[model samples]
Target: MSKNPLTTILEANIFNGTNYNDWLRNLKIVLDFENQTYVLDMYLPRALPEESTHEERLTFEKWHKDNRKVCSIVLASMTNDIQKQYDRHDDVRPIMPRMSQIYAVPDQHIRYAATKVFFDTKMIERSSVQEHGVKMLYLVEKLGDLKADLAKEMYIDVILQSLHPSFDSFIVNYNMNGFDKDLHELINILVQCKATIEKSAQSVLVREASTSKAKGKGARCWRRNKGKTESTTASAQSAPVAPLGMGKGKRKAVRQSLIPKDVCINCHEKGHWKRECPKLLPNQAVKLISANGLQVVNRSRRLRQTVLKFSNGRVVATLV
Candidate 1:
């Protein structure tokens, strides 16, 4: 293939079909691609071996050794074009050790200006909760006692705006129902503010599941060994662990009474349930009367007697 001097290095096999990041990583080692016309002040300074971890230092050393003939070496410092105020020397010192094990030290901040960003599904699932949680918690902690809904909304918006390209992808295969639509809409609304709804929701459910399982297993095991000699002795020796924060005012949930399947409230029949009742109320006198044959009867006295007997289930004797 016919190629110009500027484009000759682009043909190098290092970039064979790899993604943007992988291609950049491979090409950086195999070829010197920096243009002589570009000024150093325009570009952000690269981290030096002295401040970087062992692996990073090694990588930097290797890159310099390979490209020493073409590119000049410069230390990352306060003089460099800092993308953020927090990107200063002292601020990044605590995070340097993590570079030994990590492949990339990506700045995850949601910057107002254009900057480098990337995303992967694996990272989304793994650190989505922690990263977003930290952001939300930081905001909430900073705001302290201010309205939670407002704080959450603001935080979620920040996170959504800060989303890496990969996380913004939409999968159209799944068919969502009304409930799913509502939850997703809520999550999206929250996501727009900076709060991680999905991760936080998942974490809460997982926590409850684990706690419930543990309690169930403990109760089952305890019951199984209730009469055993070792368990009896252990129980007798150890002091009981009292429940925390439980008080007389705190009420436990009462399970709802089950509806009888074969009973009908409308018909007073024993075939179907109250929920399936289809009868409509008839328009009649509110009070039913046994006025077929009456011999000078007092309505109020009779009504009082009927009410007393119906309420107490007792028939009082009357002198004739």
Candidate 2:
């Protein structure tokens, strides 16, 4: 006598009408594996004394025992209300159908709900298109289980309808060449399309960033050039008046005007007096003054003639 295999295992998962089909299918597999599926079938009719044998009696007893065991396990797994309602029944057949009819939601309700979810589903901006497509396919499966199955074409159409306007070109191209593709194929194309769009957007952002950087650099360059131009103007404004063909009194007045003001006269730079200028080296200072078309004058009392030469070979005479 082989012991029942199901008795050795842990209790099966409780069945509520919610996942009745799956639970029932698993239970059937367990029963079949144990060679006790006869428990689910109708009981045999009573045998006459003349027709009955010892082996037949034992077989019937074993079948009845196995049937009672299966029923008890199923009842134990149910919720309180369902357990109480079905607990009195010792046979599997009556309990199975009654529980199914009482607990399972109507196919019409499931179909309507599934259809609503399928059509209302849209790809959110933050969510990947693949994830949205997956959710849509799951809803389609729910509809299929409720006997409202959609064809491949209908599935594609629903997904396309749910897409946002950004995907219009993808939708159009998909429609042109996607007649023979399945659900997963369509999802793959949408995913690729999404990646392409993102890549293009990233490229645009990079280009904009480059353009902004260039504009910033140009602005900085302009500011630098403007500062140089302003410094040149200030230097020219503070320049000494030329002493060409002027009298001693006029030369003295021009010398007074050439005295250092706010910035160095030699370098024309701020933050120091002309005598303290870093570029006031004997050779460099003369070259800088000559470059600016200016000449140095000494304040000696002797009437010595000093000649100042310019880059264009023009000479100016000043008396000191």
Candidate 3:
């Protein structure tokens, strides 16, 4: 065996029961660099030939040595549990295929997962459109790697559909113009559209703030006016009630009404009850003085009328 002083370790991520494809690719690259990849490609014979040449023996010995190295690299990359499963194998070729059987995902499942990424990804609140566009492109690239049957235009459509509703008009404009855009072109257009949307959103917020301020001021004014009206009514109600029959030139402000609810039995004038008339002295029947200085007194009777007499003995004033 030619010991060509190979010192390159497998510069690969550890395979923790997942990421089998990545780990496998890294393993191959490292093995190829070390000239040990043939150990994986060729199958070993059950035993050395009985009458083999020195060249055949050397080939078997070289293969056997490289196979051990490859197996060592594979086991080093796997987790403890997974390494135990493949470490028993003497041939390096079967180990890789066997590991693949356990860890490698099916093509259909990978395709489903990639398709789900396209549908599940979206531009959300407070997220940048540039980031959203870039992410969408990345997923499309992944799908392409998996040989997904989506066309280039379908990639553009999927990104547009996944964007926020603020881009609804932008999408419509894109479709109406019928422009063919690659992923990068779409991303560039979205960046510009994002700026426009943000500018318009700022302007709308300013207008809304102004409108709300106006509404708030109007509401305050209305409440102030309502309070003033209530205060005026309260002041008018609590003001002193004056005597009835004020002269037009000397009248005090009348609040509700000068008349009481009960009829005046003495004057029969309905302004107040029997003795409560302003014309009566306290504890006296209602009395009115005639032009001749004679006093007419009222004695309340069931009859509604009382007659008055003057000093000249004439029936001058009659009250009913």
- Tell me, by TM-score, which candidate is best: 3
Rank order (by lDDT, best first): 3, 2, 1
Encode model 2's per-residue lDDT on 48-76: one tens digit a residue: 36578989888878887888778876776
lDDT of 2: 0.76
Which 10 successive residues of model 1 have the least lDDT summed? 112-121
- List TM-score per model, in order: 0.16, 0.56, 0.57
Give the TM-score ranking, best first. Answer: 3, 2, 1
Q: For model 3, what is the error of residue 288's alpha carbon versus the real structure, in angstroms, after optimal superposition?
A: 26
lDDT of each: 0.41, 0.76, 0.78
- Model 1 alpha-carbon miss at residue 94, Å: 44
Instruction: State which candidate, 1 or 3, has the greater lDDT.
Output: 3
**Candidate 1's error at 259, in angstroms?**
56
Stretches of candidate 3 exceeding 4 Å from the true structure: 1-13, 25-73, 88-94, 120-122, 241-245, 252-320
In terms of TM-score, how similar is model 2 to the real structure?
0.56
Clashing pairs in 3: none
Q: Measured by TM-score, how close is model 1 to the native structure? A: 0.16
Give per-residue CA lDDT, model 1, range 1-320, as digits (tens): 23224433434422222233333343343333443222211232356745677887775555444333223221121123321322432322222233223433232322211122211112244355345544544444433333223434444444444444434532221122222333235445435433454566779999999999999999989877875867778875773433567553332211112333576777898766554555532222222233422423675556555532436667555433
lDDT of 2 at 103: 67
